[model samples]
Target chain A: MMFYINQTSCISPQEFILFDDNHILRKATGGKLFALEPNYKNIPSAQLRRMGKAVRFGVGAALPLLQQGNDVNGIIIGTANGGMEDCMKFLKQIIEFDEDSLTPGNFVQGVPNAVASQLGLLSHNLGYNITNVHRGLAFENSIIDALMLLNEHPLNTYLLGAVDEISDFNYKIELLNGNYKQQSNEGTDFYESGSQGSLAGEGASMFFVSNKKDAAIAKLEFVETIHSSDEEEILNWVEGRLGSHLIEMDKIDLLLTGENGDNRVLKYYTAIESIFNNKISIARYKHLCGEYATASAYAVWLICELFKNSKVPLHIMKVGTPPQKIEKVLLYTNYLGEQHSLMLFSKVK
Target chain B: MTAIVVTGLGIISSIGNSAEENRESLIKSRAGISKNNNFYSRYSTLLPFGEIKKSTAQLMEELNANEKGVTRTSLLALHSIQEAIEDSKLTLNQISSSDTALIGASTVGGMCLTDQLFIDATTASKGSEYLSSYDCASVMLYLQNRYKMKGIVNTINTACSSSSNAIMCGARLIKSGLVKRAIVGGSDSLSKFSINGFNALHILSSDICRPFDANRSGLNLGEGAAFLILEKEEDCKGKKVYAKLSGYANTNDSFHPSSLSEDGQGPFLAMTQAIESASLDASSISFINAHGTATENNDEVESVAMRRIFEKVPAFASTKSYTGHTLGAAGAIESIFSVFNIINQEVYSSLNYTSPIEKTGLVPNLNYRKTSVQHVMSNSFGFGGNCSSLIFSKH
Candidate 1:
């Protein structure tokens, strides 16, 4: 089934507004990197006060994609560590107060679906709302859900998105777990230089998808996920997805890898790079967005940008000359040496 | 489109450990709510809960899941998922195949081990071993690793309607030819975190929850796990098909974070949409497993919604009285009950239900009855104004 991306919105470290040519790609001296703050002057301050950073980013990213109270048939979200600040606050309250007189606000905000449901509650769209919280594959799950929904109904406008946040506690926990580096380093050359850990980053992206091709930003042709270490398995998965769509390996003009300057996890991307024979134009996003579970959501947003501009930002794109006519872009990201996800987007000409 | 068939069933709840045991409790009108004993909390002496009798250690020992960072949520999930895979007669190869998908849901997850999480996140004494168990997807990832499931594994958390959404997502994946079969359900073990969280909401009933009761005060928090093995009709040709997942719908109240609208628009739309999806009229519904949370807000709103949908409301009951609100697991746990209604051709009573709400004047099925039940509609509403309904028809 063909699904068109009607609109896209994202809140990341880099300015997401159109015509913003600023390239801010540097590893954080601080441990955590926050998404660029979006103006929320329109939302009620009372309701806004109760939300956390993640909720604000999610609602901020989603509210703009809707067509002023349009009947959105589904609201699907993907998040790795949703509302971590609220979750940690609630957890802290439970521990400090010894389970006595705890506020309900933190607990309410801690839910993974809080962002999606909050969007639905705000827009008054009583359609299907679900939140996928599968570590690295969270946003990919949302894509699959959007595809399945469109395949089943073929005429429904759906809101699909992802969100994640980093709390001080979340950052500390990751640091203790050795998932991120404590050392500060410039990330512009993230592919060549970095410590043992990748910089922790958080962001949110929302897409309005439907069967209608009118006013679409891009067309999503294929998406798949696999948990495998076998090179042949990965190759076969990609080949099968492209083959079923009657596309070939050489037709894939660009490949987006989820390499985040972490040498340990770079092998997965290297394997994919080998499959494309180093011929396809390849780019990287983690240098700009840093490393997080749903960082691929940011990669997808970047893909939409490449489709619109046909220009790859030099600060993040790595290896291979840019294709003269960017037609098809493939995204490959793996989290924690497991959960490998691949997505293919094509310009809807 | 291939019909989604329920070929296997598993359950571990406060009242029972297996599907058959739960079925028996349903028929016998056994209520599981009691003073919290297995788990200790500040509200242990004050509120009743549907706490399973087994201790966490005992569960881990029995399941042979003695590993670092293994939480009670994973243990409960393992028990139910193992039962489901076995009941489906699936081999190890099939369990590990890329054609099989596992969709699990849970809200508490490892947060059930609140003390360990607290210590791990705080003071940081060698970072407690349970640090990795706190996310909503921990239990699901643990199960996926256990079975080596590779096909579209996902975790969903929409509060009370989580597992129902998981089940719906699984079926949609199958219908879209993404997977051949899916093991779908949710698990949540009772913990001080949820108990205190609900207590803070001022919705924890001190007595056993009286769902649909006119004087119903609040809900009693509970936890457990339940799973269903759903396969395409072609794959389950000769299998024991319990029921067909005919239709499902989810709608948002868009009204509040924790409360439904006074008109019950969310529940009403969910019920009507689900029936319409099944290509069946509202009157075709034989029974309804209402989302009667027994809270002052939920019961009345659900009744109003039911009145708006079913001209003559079908024989409906809130099994939440049997298994206190299981949060993320409530959807799947009650879905299993709905399937059992189709399989056994019986309608179980809503335990402790007294007079109906004065506004709608709707009384649930107060007694168990053996009848010809063709379709059973189950409802699950969550804190985010997420309301979902699923229709299961006899195969």
Candidate 2:
């Protein structure tokens, strides 16, 4: 079974336009990286202004695509940090206000499925709605749910995506644990020559999945995620999946690894580098978008563009191989060696 | 119709940490709900909970685990998963990595660490050493990394129905040929936020929940995780099958965030679809593990749904009476209960029930009765109008 991407929207540190934007690999920096394209005013109004960063990114990412697929059968949104930002904010407010009276906005938005609920209210698409909130597996589970729906009834469209945001506490905790370096400036290049760590970036990528196959840009062939045991196990598993699909080791054209310049995780993807024999082009997105739990979602949106436009961005592409046939591309990513995801896609007819 | 079979099962709740213990507890009508052990807050004194009597130290010793900061949620997940995987008798290391997938659910992954963070969030810039636990995804990913499975480690949190969705997704994986075997379950530990949040809603009972009763006031929150190892029909050809997962469906109310829609439309859609999906007549179901949160709004909506779907309402009871609302683990935990119905051929009572709610004229069984059980239907509805019902049939 296959599902079509009827419409897709994203909110990244770069421009807030959809993935079809002209500017490729727009650089992001500063204390916190937010989607350049988020137009909160365009999505909703002051009545629901209490939404946190996750909800805003979620709405901005989904609304436009949903408008195109208003008749979409269902909505499934994935959030790594659903209402954490709201929860944190609410907890702080309660502490500061001496618990006199708590506001409903924070508590309402703090619910894990707030984004999905708000989407239901906004679009009035009452067919089916589910919000999947598993850290790195957030989008994977959402994608799987959407796939199941497509299998049962071939729902014409599904709003599928992932969103995560970093709070002041996120950075403060990082700084305390040495995950964040001290004295880093606003313009610091996270993966530059002297850069030591990846900057924190947050956004949402919502896809309008359908089965009509009309004017479709890409079709989802198959996607899988695994929790890797170690560096050796991840590569072998990737090879194993490729073999099961009747594709050989040497045939893989592009291998997108979720390496965030971490010495440990980078090495896991590194061992497979020679196995690809440099014939398979290797790509890393943490340099472009920075690293978080669901950085792979951004990586996937990036690869979707690469499939459409054969010219890959030189900045993000690590190893080079031209998109000669662009027939089958294998995208692989690991979240700190715990949950690893692989999405195989081919240019559809 | 595609058939998804439940080849194996495992569970760990306050009442019973193992399948055998759980059955005995259910037969005797013993409850695991009690008071809190921590001296963390005054709320513990006010709230008697379905607290798992075991301590973290004891769980660590049982698993022989070296790593620390593993939340009670994770521990419950590991415990249930170990039994489930073992019950399936499928060698984990023997199967191809691509054919095995691990799907776990949790509402809050490591918020158990939040108590430790609470101290630091105010005084210092950061919390304790385990900032990673603060992210729900991180905890799940940690589980995936530990297991070394390559197929999928997807975490789902649709509020309370989170685990039920996880199990359904696992079955779909098998039906889709994504994997031949999938490990599915959900886990959640009681936390300050959930306890306080439910308290704020004024939908929490100070004592054990009396579900489906006329005077049913509110729900009791509990903690634990349960899981089942699902395999393709071919994978379990001659094995003794515990129960077959025949039909399952999930529907949303799209109503209020915390409350169900007035018409019980969510459960209405879910039950009908599941029954239809199972390709079985409504009369086939002999028992139902109702969500029956006992909140004024929940019990009415759900029972109205049960009455609407089944011409003769089956012997339905809310097991939440014994195992509070386990949150993300409710679906998996109840799935085990439903399977027990398939095995024991008996219906457990809805404890502390004096009269049925007049709104629907629906009355849950107030006492245990022995009978032949054929099909059991389990329903789990979460905060987001996410409603899911799964059907388990005698194999």
Candidate 3:
């Protein structure tokens, strides 16, 4: 099943606009890459004050698209850790005050579904609303659901997105867990650094998906998540998907890999690269967006840009030359060698 | 399109540990809400909770779940899912097949270790073993790894309606031909995090909860897990067919973050749309398992919505009075109770009910009796106005 990406928006550590030659590459500082949030002047001041980082970035990225006079039939969001700051605050208060005299503000905002719910309330979309909280496959699951729903409705458009924010407490814990790199590296050099850990990052990316192709920028060909650590099994699964879709290796113009500079897991990507046989131009994105569960959302956003601009950004291209006329792109990402996901996108003809 | 049918059912709640035991408890009019004995919280003594009579250590020992970073939430889920798979007679090959999907839901997955997490984050330079199991996805991840499930695995967290949406999503997956079978349900264990959170909200009842009663107080928190195996009707050759998933609909109220609208717009739309999707008239519904959290706002709003949807409201009762509002697991547990209503051809009484609310003057069924139940509707509403209604019918 294929659905069209009619409109899209993203808020990441890089600039919000499309990349240009003069665009400065933003690098991680102190092993953490935070989202470059837009000024949420469009949202009400009172409401803005009550929103958390994830909610703000999610809603801020989606509100402009929704304001363009499109009636969305559903709102689906994916997040790994939702409203961690608020949750941590509530937990601290409970421990401090002994669970007494505590308010309900943080408790309500800390739920995993808060971003989707806030989108629903703000957009007045009473239709199907849900949130997916799977680890690295969170955003991919959301897209799968949206496509299935589009298949069911046929005429309805859906607002689909993924958002995650880094909280100070969670960052500290993850750092201790050895999930992030101990030393900071330049964004462009992080992938080749062969470090033990990846930089911690956060972002939000939203899209308007529908079955109709009118005004579409790109078409989603396939999406799947594999739960295997065996390199041979993962390779076989990817081959099976390509064979099922009848997509030849030569038809794919670019291969986007989610290499987060974690040396231990770089072998998985090396195995995937063998399948393409070095024929396809390969690019990497975790350097710019950092490594989080749903960083695939940013990858999709970059694919949209590649198709819209008909050029691959030089900063992201790692191997081979940039495709002169981009048509099809395949994305493969594995998180900590446990969760593997593959997505294919094509330019609308 | 082939109909989706439930082939197996498993439940562990305050009432019982299995489906048969739960039914027996309900028939005997035994309410499970009482003072907490296993969970240690500041409100444990002052308030009543429908806590299962087993500690985390006991559950771990019984389930043989000695894996690192395993919390009570995952243990409860493992207990029920094991029963469900065994009851369905699914072979190991079928269990590991890519055609079977697992959709789990939870509001408090590993947050049950909030105290441990706080202590570790505050003092320990190196994170503890519990660090890997601290997010909402840990429960499902643990289950997926344990079962070796290779198909689509996803977790939904729409608060109270989490598992109902899980069931609904599983049904959709089957209907879309994405998978042939889906093991769907949810589990939530008692935690100081949730107890204190609900206390902060001022919705925890000190005494036993009395849903639909005029002077009903708030709800009592509970913990448990329930899972139902759903397969296409054509696929279940000789299995025990419990109920057919006929209809389901999810709608947001777009109102307040915590409260429903005065008119219950979300509930009304969800119920009506579910009925329409089932291609049945409103009068065809024989019983309704209401969301009825026994709160000042939920019971009244749900009542208003039921009245608006059904001309002569059918026999309806809130099972939360029995299970004490098991947040994420409430939908699946209540849904299994609804299936029992169809399978046994009987209705269970709503305990601790005296009078109906003055506004709607609605009265729930008060006695256990045999009846002809054809179709049953189950409602679950959660925070952010996430309301969902599911309809099940006799197979």
Candidate 4:
């Protein structure tokens, strides 16, 4: 049994939008590309007070849209570097203080699941809860958990979310590695050309998933996660999955790839684009949101939106006419050469 | 329609080194928790834990795996996974390396090594090798590379629910026909990072934790590992079935980021869903293995969750009072404990309890109790409102 997306929110370099409520995103932050901060103070000052950047950003995005008159059956979050700031500090202390002279506060919040745990505490939800860290696959697997749980327990709605923060150590590493792409030209009076690199951006995206479809914006069709990077298997699997549907590859309108403007990654996308050709709209979101392990989480969020709103924002485009009605979108991503995930979504009109 | 069957299990915790040892210890009401034995901590006067008595080096020797970079955590994991994989009657090398073998190695893995690695990242070239050990997912990759696991190798770090989620993910894979078999569980070793983390929150008890007790001080931080072999039923036909993992559910309390909601709503919902998934009534739950970290908030909230759902909340006990909270390993650790109790038809005592909490008046079984139990429900709740409960039934 497939679950439906009731609502979603994403805090990224792009302007915030309810994931399923809107479709088609444009580069709204002037291509200046910065983390999208939310109005946490608006809901309740106290809740936002103790929240670190990760908590504030995640809750600020999901809590609002998931206000469905009920506590979600579960909250599933995947963070690549959860409170590494606290963890790093704790590590520094253990090293300096010789282990005995330390406190557990930072260490307590250091676990990857801490993000989802704190959210549960604040919301007073004591249900099935989990936080997964498979890098980019984290979000994909979290979605899989949410969907699987819904299938097992029909009424158990879920808040499936992912948050990645830019840490000094990691951010610096990306820069030296040439993965960050911040262009030098005058603002795009907007010409679309594929780039070779993009700045690393970080944010949290959450979806209110439920068995209830009337309120759903779209249906999460199929999600596949593979460890080997064998392009042959990936291609065969993709085409095989497509064959299982009533519609064929030609029916797909939008294809999203996890290209952070890195030439190597872009080349991977080109390989994919070459396969799709001009038959489908190809979009690279790394320029808009940068690259983090779970960046395609935002890609999945945007594709759902594009299908619902029937337009693509100028910020995430390469080319092609905006479709009148979108039917299918495929989200593909890879992280550290270990996990490559592909998620297929179908509009629920 | 498909069913999830738990065929093999393995564990290395404070209470026991294997499933039989754990069962015997639990039946005797023997507690594995004591004062921190290995780590030199400043809070020794304020916090005690379910720390393993053996040193990390000794544990490595016990496993005969000193070269595995021997964090007591991975060593513990090696013991458990090897047992589980063997119990499953399957070998990674025999499985064609083509079938996806997903192992959910959770924990802030290698935190113990992190302190040394951090000091070395700046000090020596040998230290750089430890950098790969820092990431939790790296543990799975290391194991895959070490054992040549031909299947999908992955890690899930869901805190206390870590191993439970790992088990759940693996079960789903088998049930959905996505994979042939999976080796899933969690591994965590005690370290100053976790020991003191609980201390700072003032949640660590000075003595052994007394879950559900009014006098319960807090949890005794402990560390260890646990795992299970989840294979499709067709493949496990002739194998001994330890228990049928009937239902499992995970929920996030949107109430707070750290503490559970007032009514323990998330846990209550999770239990309800898990029970429903098993297609059984709450009455069928002959015993309940509570997460019972023994912290005031946990005891109160979890008991409230139990009360809200179980009309007669079957006699329950928090084995944490014995093993200490093993962080990520608690889920699998306790799951193995539950199956052990089910097989033996006994409930372990919730050691070191003086009285029951005033709110629910729920008292964990502090004395060994024997009963013909058919199904056992186990719960694990964590920070970030992460909550999960699973139902294990006798075959």
Off by over 4 Å in 2: A16-31, A93-105, A174-189, A192-196, A248-257, A280-283, A307-329, B92-97, B119-129, B138-146
True contacts kept of each: 0.75, 0.51, 0.77, 0.59
Residues A1-349, candidate 3: write the lDDT tens digits: 7899999998899885445867887778888898898888878899999988888888998988888888899999999887888888889999999888998888888887889999899988899999999878889889989988998999999999999998888887777777787786756677777878789899999999998787799999989887888888988988898898888889899999998898878889998899988888998989889999989999999899899888887778878988897989999999888889998999997
lDDT of 2 by residue, B317-348 (tens): 89888888989899999999998888878888
TM-score of each: 0.97, 0.91, 0.99, 0.84
What are the lDDT scores of the predictions, listed in order? 0.86, 0.74, 0.89, 0.71
**Root-mean-square deviation per candidate:** 1.9, 3.2, 1.1, 4.9
DockQ for candidate 3, C-alpha atoms? 0.80
- The lowest-lDDT stretch of 10 consecutive residues in candidate 3 chain B is B119-128
DockQ for every model, please. 0.73, 0.48, 0.80, 0.36
Q: What TM-score is obtained for chain B in each of the predicted models? A: 0.99, 0.96, 0.99, 0.94
Error of 1 at A19 (Å): 8.4
CAPRI rating of model 1: medium
Candidate 2 on A25-132: residue-level lDDT in tens? 555445455556545655657634767777787777778776664666778888777766777776665456534345556766776777887676677655577777
| DockQ head-to-head 1 vs 4, winner | 1
**Worst-scoring 10-residue span by lDDT in model 4 chain A:** A184-193
Off by more than 4 A, model 3: none
Worst 10 residues of 4 chain B by lDDT: B120-129
User: What order do you get sorting by lDDT, best first?
Assistant: 3, 1, 2, 4
